[model samples]
Target chain A: MSRTFYCRGQTGQQLLLGAYGALCRQVGLGRVKMFPRTEMLDLVVAGGRARGIVTRNLVTGIVEAHTADAVVLAAGGYANVFFLSTNARGANATSIWRSYRRGAGFANPCFIQVHPTCIPRSGDFQAKLTLISEALRNDGRVWVPKRRGDTRSPDAVPENERDYFLERMYPGYGNLAPRDLASRAAKRVCDHGCGVGPGGRGVYLDLTAAVAGLGEKVLCERYGNLFEIYERISGENPLHTPMRIYPAPHYTMGGLWVDYGLQSTIPGLFVLGEANFSDHGANRLGASALMQGLADGYFIIPYTLGEYFGGAALGEVSPSDRPFVEAAKEVEDRLARILAVQGKRTVDSFHRKLGAILWEHCGIIRNAAGLGAAVEKIRLLRAEFWENVLVPGDAADLNQELEKAGRVADYLELGELMCRDALAREESCGCHFREEFQTACGEALRDDRRFGHVAVWEHAEQEREPVRHVEPLTFETIIPAERSYK
Target chain B: MKFTLFIWRQRNRGDRGRFVKYELNDADPGMSFLEMLDFLNQRLIERGEEPVAFEHDCREGICGCCGMVVNGFPHGPEKGTTVCQLYLRHFQEGAHIHIEPWRSRVFPVIKDLVVDRSVLDRMMRAGGFISVPTGSAPEANTVPVPKEAAEVAMDAAACIGCGACVAACPNGAAALFVSARLGHLGLLPQGQPERERRAKAMIRRMDREGFGACGNHRECEAVCPKRISIRFIARANRDFLKAFFVHPGKA
Candidate 1:
């Protein structure tokens, strides 16, 4: 009766609900209750199995323990921990990793995906920028000012003066150089002052020609919403003008290490959807996140859980077992400590600081010195955060502030692991680009010899560094080679 | 360029919301409507006033998050566009723009402009997916669907679920959303096993959710953020009719 399913809102919840409904219908069970944005502190470990979960309900200010035969963690990935993210509010990488680290689970805290095409920087106060999908690159063209010092308006610039670099470099894929390559190329151009937009941080994604040639109806059929989004963000009509876009940290392809059964190293503890590092190896393809999330929830978890539960004698063992009760108390204690702090710095303040370091150092083009500096800075910030940080409201009620503090607390620790992961992996591959590993053509040079394996970090005691476990990636279909856009 | 905006300001669904005007000077023609609102918000923040709240995500038009009535159109003056992508260039300098949230019974206005579209999610929950239990990753090619069918399914899958079609329709019908789901599942072999039951269950759930019946205004197709075709609606109707006879008990 106490089996708890913890998942993110919107897509993840829908997937789980659908699966739950199907399973309940098939097995003749009672109705299922859904909780949104709740935090799981730890798994109740009794007899070496995940007996239940100790969780805090974010909506109503109650700290209740749910003892279940099993706990499903589908809370999503840590893209929100980065200074600039394409993710929503709850997905702070550091906090989620720390929560698992507190328990017995492997957190691959470093596998973040920086989406190549997002609306470029608009202002400093902008918390999170919007993403324009890579699918647009299929038909749309990416261009920048040919002249190094040119700062002309998109309309003012002549066609000859604009450099269609993606088209020039890759005759076949053109603007579609997968997400990673396209993003790097855009960054390279912008770094060279060919960047468009007000901050000079983005390039122009021109579809004027496409619109004119395809006619409004055909073009509208394809990219109508994108056009609307562009207008909403940039305040310009794309029917006549080109859109300004750049890359931002969108999705995290990495997370808690899960096996084929979607179970992490911990027994009776399962991770699904974006929370588990299952699908989308290094960089995720467009429209794949939804597919992967639904796939895990609807198609993957139900089958796997049945096998797990069958071994546990179905509903014979409930979460109310002793291990679950003990774990629930520990979670309550952790929440009490957070509320006890009552410090000064807001959660947003700490998160913003953490995000800035990650974005500047561990983001896009990272170097060893930058990564090292990031770790030192993050450690200093963590010290200040724990001491001076403030939670504005009580944990009860619809407290967004309390929820943010909890998520950010994890980000602080997770940020350190990200820098460490970046530091450990010296080779440039996929979204993880190190300045040290580039060819003469300025393309990423993958050092497959030492860095091809997935770095799964085992949680160590506080103040002690975590141990690294490498899961060797064996490519079956696609050969690992220099990813050439040209 | 300077322009005036007439925006709908509603506290909640029950309250009668009206148009509020604001002026913007030195605005770029290329800036999106949301960006203009962002600019307006920046000014409001400086003045220590609360800014207008609106819903949006995945500016690429894939997430089905943002939608609004702009200048009497679901997206804006520009046909087939979402509110996020409509730029100011379409408007004449000094012209007035009207902005409002999608009007429908199912989508109750939550704040100034945001509406609770969880009704659509509820409908999907009724029976939007196949009865495949989660386990191993099936080879994508395991189903052996024809390339043409897959492409058709992919087209239907492009629906972002922004609810623009419902907003645009005079009847407040969710035919576009329903049709997109129907089309996606109907064409695929993976969806074959539960086709009739799914059709009946989804329609019954849609009716249960208090969404108005489709009136064939075709406005849903016109304002769809994805420009999802009306053909899907036809396909849905055909499937529903077939399911009604084939699985009468489910209906």
Candidate 2:
């Protein structure tokens, strides 16, 4: 597996470069027209099918209509809704949410993957978090102070007293365990005051033995960029300091719900990559995110799209068509509304406050009471957001504030639905851990009879009132059992 | 902890940018440079003013979408740091910082502090690739690359396409970015078949895009966020020269 997939620490980048290179090649050959920095604003639906889109040329600030036979959304994830996430800064849920408003279903959105090993958030000013890839766990052993709130240097913490918790609990997998399992273990220990670092929410991922076994140069060859990123962020070299890591919102498994062929609830509207909730039920496995993205783009979309095109192309529509104009007007009107407010609070201020609520209630741990409470709070926040979001700039130009306000507006709505979904599920499974549904031994207890179904949510006008349609899970071969890392 | 920042401000692509000073009273020292901008932007909204626009994504420095000239240095004062990772801790208590966008004719200003980087993508479009069709490639281990060669390829592959090299270069050259891509693919066995063709096509495209030739000024490596060395430029020089002599003679 190491030789087959690992392209050092840059596998994702390498694969993307290959794909981007191919796309760029098509652009150069005049085979595929590339809109360099255009961002999608809304979907144009006609005759109960998605026919085109409204896009803003980010450079020129021109909103244009692009009528197409199909609208494919590979527009990343919603992890950025969590202020301190390991997603690209521009990655947002606006595109998916717009499609949802145009009548698409969002599925399992509460199943957000929290990474076990991320550079701990330094302060309130952090724009985005960096992920120390799980591959480093192949050599590094995770540990913390056996005694809670120990302040001594790591060198002084004796080996006998040190709690290598991952190694202690799961002898076989240890630090190399799956993402959700590792994140839960770290959180569990931290909850007990055994966590290290400034906020006492971090555990040490030590690499002493790894450096000894495989020379520093070898590791440098493989993970030099990651190590450098760590040092730059934390101001501590991993060669000496055990990396202080805490769980962070890395990926969101839930997205616009799609069928087996990768078509969304809307006809002619396709979804892929992290945008579509297709593969990796509940939690994703290591190396699978990139695999899924590449597979969807190269294999699945081509075949499925070909099949769709074989049926019929959309009716002839121009930029001034009724559907295109209506979609364009909808986008322009929203932007105008955001600008007209001229209210007190910034979009980010409201966003930060909303993030704290969701993180405290719906994040990591959830319960009926907490989830229900979060939904109510989200409603108030959403109301305040529209009334006082303070989107300063007008819609006449390229306003960064306008763009963010729109994304945050969508997040405020999506946040409520996520909590409602969490509240609906009575059983704990995968990354969706409801506190009331846990077993006596502290493992996630699944209720296969009642809760074994995908809760597909249709967006309703009012917050906390999304209509849910259940798609029950049917296991073909593997039987459901306890997940015992021990 | 507060400071005065002279940020570059432009209303639109056509608007001429100028330094607009603002007093940033609120901040956390731990925030990355972009986070500092986020703080300032939040304040700008409170003041009923438009926030300065800058290009950024994947603030962890992987995407190469973010760039700025800070205090006369590309990506701030820190070495091997993108503007996104440059923390406030590196600055003094009351530092008066000058922030500007990348200065290049080819990469024109789109808005305040944001430039059109479509040219770099165009350079990549010219040739930066292996010609293998999807799903037709053999087993990964089929091509046995020596460890040293693989390591070198990884080192060269670390370029994020950030265009810092072009911004920092006195001649506004994109040689470093092109060389890094060239070095990454040209060293590997899989990239050998189209090495000559790749070199010619990419070089021609860079010239056509109006990027200046490499003037051997090492400012590119000095200000590069990824700290990619200029050795790849030397490698690209060799590839281009060899391709020159061989292209017409081959047929």
Candidate 3:
């Protein structure tokens, strides 16, 4: 059996505060200067190394440059490219996307993790989906109505008529199945018109049996906050009725390619946390992300960074240098281009369209035909975005629309690249599930001999196809084994 | 659902902000407050108008990046709920909602509903953490903490640092916010050595940042999205009083 640690339902939040406290202490000691209310637009590479970054002040909207010895991007992942992901509203791929454009190798862009137990999207106007902690799966039984198109409430459905799908499919793991498998199973059932909740796009996560077995008091001690959150959002009590959950893009295992020292393909550019495509392979176990982030930030980077600083032959750099000035100008021009569009459709309208295309074709499952069509559709949509996307705000102000427009523009390109990556990988391995390459029982068929390598893509110039590079994997310690839940 | 929103609008930090009236006729009941605002902004953008600028990161309410006052309530009328989690269903159809930024002298408006909350970070920087060696993860059970103490610390640690407490306080005091951190660190065994230091330094920084002293109005406790009790403030005050005699100015 595996074990995990948590702080109730707020582990992520508590960990963030701890990290923020450490950062603030450094800021207080004058060791670190935090540039809050500022968004990075581009990475500054001088003499073939990352020297600084260009940022637009979110308050003033003025593009400026800051030079540094070694730039570390803890900028986070691009799961937001899916648009209705569990990521923050401001969470975008702009930082890493710009870095990719500047020569960082983006590895496995298609390996996006869709969490199984997220609060289902209520409507098209939903800003972001909330994730119900996976830990609840230990106590909650996942189910759906056996009868298709059954509109009865969860409590009203008879026990025999209910289909405990996870328990039936993978009897060994039951509700505790891995995220990718669980998410796909939920999708498969929903596709068969067996989904519960709103728009018939969710399954029931019933904790009633667990609560009855372990008493409400015991359950409350463990998941009180989560239950409260569920009630507040969906207006249904999990203790009284089962929670309706659906799969939503929660994390990305694909990011900037890094070596053993966490340095990206670009020298002097260190990537950390979810931003780097290190640690978690294609599918991540729950609570491991926190461990990986803490390990990188607290344990690993310090020594590696010290070694880098000690070994590198560096020169004095200034903000007025050619690279810095050029990067700033590039950022300014992009912002201006977005603002100058002044088209009929809103930036969000384009984002929603892009999200729909990605979700339908390149989501939990993928096929060559659908992916190829998606590529063509995205190309057309991106061109239209440049031509007709309305960004009605001044470039030199705290304009939310302008900020969104810039991020969406990057996503438009990145979304196409993600589809391209998905199309190129023919094997059904990890989260990149190619429908044509799966087993008879719907399990992902891994082709280790043919596809056991990281598909790293290099950004080509505009309107040109990106070149793909492979880093072959060699297992030295252990033999590769098939993952089975049966 | 439809509603008339009076949202604060400011071009930049220097502009005198004013509430701009917007009629959102097609807001769905299932939309969160932020999503409703997004719909409003989308319409405004289509109309060739600059959208209202509000700060939001995680719309799931954990990030503390989203904050705005709604109809005189800090995070709307929902108890222990952030504005991002507040749904349109909570409001009456065609409700006239007044949205504004956190009103505090220290938290000056950057633009519209976005305020500069760096002061809270400044106060935390004074002393919000326990000093530990930066290295590999330490062995578990090295320091056994009391169960009750850990529980209290966890409760205090739930603070999201959204500054709603400061915005809700009648005196514009950050006692609740500061006290939550103080209690979170102070109640732990690892936090013992610097306990007195933390209280004095954080309270001193609070005073230095031009925050008013708590007057026991309990307005802060009323609007805290996490429902952090004001009892943490009492604990912090006790620590601060003791800190005055123990470690006076060094921290």
Candidate 4:
């Protein structure tokens, strides 16, 4: 049903470079003026329409306002909310979160993708997890010890004793099963005390069978770079033994809700790429994020944006407008307040704690009780973060701590919203696998009749619960079918 | 494992930077270099001292936002590893690691280990991309490209624009970086329309940005996290010379 075009293991890199080249050409022509090292603090909405944005000059720490007739945001996803995700350290929900607060509807906050293949967290000091390409699943067979708490070396574990869970559970797909399914399966096995490696958190991705069949040279040629990277970080060569991998937050399917026109609730405000929750209904297919992003930028936006412009009338808007000034001031005061909190805990400490709270309750498999507990814990954590977090730096300079503090504060709020959304969506569907709603085989059970609508949450005032609004999904030609690999 | 760290601390671009020493007693061998830095920063923040400001994104080494000098190596002593991907096990226990920002006149230190590598972005803007029409997907096989050319283009496109080449260069030259950008687009048939203009503008912008001439020291390739070859520099020079002969008026 799907086809993939790739250049070795560097598909994402090649595609990004191609896009970057085009952007640079425009920049060279003086058509695009880039503001590097700048962070968007707030979205400016004047006259009930999106107009501009307030950004902090990261170099000088100056809060500046930039107004435009139309604003297009493609600021990426918020997988970093987990603290130890496969996302960049700088990746945050700030831009989209600020937009949500400024009237954009955030849809499906709980629909986050947990990638099956990632380097397992080594220690408490581990900052972020690295993702191994899904291509490894083609040859690498995922397995764990047949006995619970088996401490023997991976190679020492006899072939018969190794329980190949993926192949056992989903014989049709095996290791190549969908990310959400595989991730959930791994968690299920680990929860049952059958996990391998450190702290019983990982499973063996054994490629010995494939290597023996294909030869070491062929295996090396296929995934040489990945193998090297694995060895570099874990200090364990995959060729010698099986690789230890665990599920980690890789992407967020939830983002600022946008319509067919790629425009959010606010007029003149367009969202694209992963920033907009337009594509990938519940789970994302492999290599599709890039394709969707390219389509949004290169095709969809060109037409839809023009259509938006054609419909709207000309309004004289300037960066010195009242809305821009107020937004800029708001950003500045928030920064000042964050700096004023000269408390004990570091931003990283709070972020790590928040990550733990979410990962424990709202991660992989969630239940109503745990989600409720998570929401309460996050609320308390957010309050503690505001009052007790130490951001030791001035607002008038390039302060990474201040940036992180603001982002973490936003994540604290977003984390609660995620729990709330997850709690509301009672039935299991795709990545949102509720413990109470799964089938006998522990597969996601979708409640189409009652919960087939897209859960869109609108931001309410401080200390008030967000208003949940739904848009019913109507299937016309193609009927929604239950996914089964077995 | 215990290790002493000498970290560069700069308040801002105008501030004079100094090396601050701190002893870390609980650095795990499993922790990445950046994780170790994060551990140190957490300690500093808890002590009411400002944490080090470093630019890091996509710790997987593809984003190219993280680059620093560690023990006189661009990304530590590793052959082709970024600071984010470099692990503590690679270093000896109780080693006094000297960490600093990328040393380049063009890339002024903003605060601590964070440097203004926007110059590289500027160079990219000059002539890095192929100008294409934005619309629906173009039909594949319309313009046939040589298999070899496509492969070479991919190799050139692997540059993360981390500015490590400039930082490691003895003359602070961005020849390797610029050439990688040039080679990525120039080898493609789609890039042929504005190829000459791209080469001239990008090379001129590189010189204008105060980047020194390549001294053939091969330092950039040696320190590059992506292991981008210096051969791309030669490829860029060939394109530059052709552009120079073709468009003498622009020169």
| TM-scores of all candidate predictions against the true structure | 0.72, 0.95, 0.97, 0.97
> Candidate 2 residues B1-251, lDDT tens each?
79899999987667777899988776677777888888888777677677888888888777898899999998988998889988887889888999998988888887889888888888888889887766677877988999899888888888998888999889889999999989999999989988888888888889889989899999999988777889999998888889967776432
> Which consecutive 10 residues in model 1 chain B have the weakest lDDT in total?
B42-51
User: Model 3, stretches more than 4 Å misplaced?
Assistant: A1-6, B136-140, B248-251
Lowest-scoring 10 consecutive residues by lDDT in candidate 2 chain A?
A: A1-10
For candidate 1, the lDDT comes to 0.73
Give lDDT per model, in order: 0.73, 0.84, 0.88, 0.88
Query: Total clashing residue pairs per candidate?
Result: 40, 1, 0, 2
Q: Judge candidate 3 at residue B142 and give its lDDT.
A: 93
DockQ of 1: 0.13
What are the runs in model 1 whose C-alpha is more than 4 Å off?
A1-42, A56-58, A88-99, A103-108, A125-127, A133-143, A154-178, A205-232, A235-243, A278-346, A386-393, A437-453, A469-486, B1-251
In candidate 2, stretches whose alpha carbon ends up further than 4 angstroms from where it belongs are A1-8, A209-222, A462-464, B25-27, B249-251
TM-score of chain B of 1: 0.94
As a whole number from 0 to 100, the lDDT of residue A365 in candidate 3 is 96
Model 2 per-residue lDDT tens digits across residues A1-486: 131223545778877887787787777778889887778989988888889999887555688889888989999889888777888878889899999988999998888998888988777666677888777787788999999999888878999999998888788777777778788889989999999888888999998778888989987866777788888788888877789999989888899989877899999999999998878778777768888887898789989998888886667778888889988988888878888887788888888888888888877878999988998899899988888768765666777778888889989988888898899888988888889989897778899999878889997774447799988889999988888877
TM-score of chain B of each: 0.94, 0.97, 0.96, 0.96
Which residue ranges in model 4 land beyond 4 Å of their true spot? A1-8, B136-140, B249-251
TM-score computed on alpha carbons, candidate 1? 0.72
Looking at candidate 4, what is the lDDT of residue A329? 91
- On DockQ, the leading prediction is 4
| Better by DockQ, candidate 4 or 2 | 4
lDDT tens digits, residue span B40-128, model 3:
77777777777777888887777886889999999999999999999888899889999999988988988888898989888888998
Better of 1 and 2 by lDDT: 2
Summarize candidate 4's per-residue lDDT along A1-486 as a digit string, tens digits. Answer: 212322455777766776676676677777888787789999999998888899998778899999888899998999899999988788889999999999899999999999999989888888889888878888889999999998999888898998999999989888889999899889988989999877899998989898889999988877878898899988988987899999999999999999988999989889998888878988888878988887898778989988888988859899888999999999999998998988888888899999999999989999999999999999999999889989887887778888899999999999999999999998999899999998897788999999998999999987789999999999999999899999
Clashing pairs in 4: A21-B129, A88-B58
lDDT of 1 by residue, B1-251 (tens): 89898888775556798889888887776666776886676565444444565776544444566687787778777766677666677789999888888788788876577777877766676777766654443765766888788768767776767888888888777888888887888898777878877777788888888778888888887777667898998899899899868877645
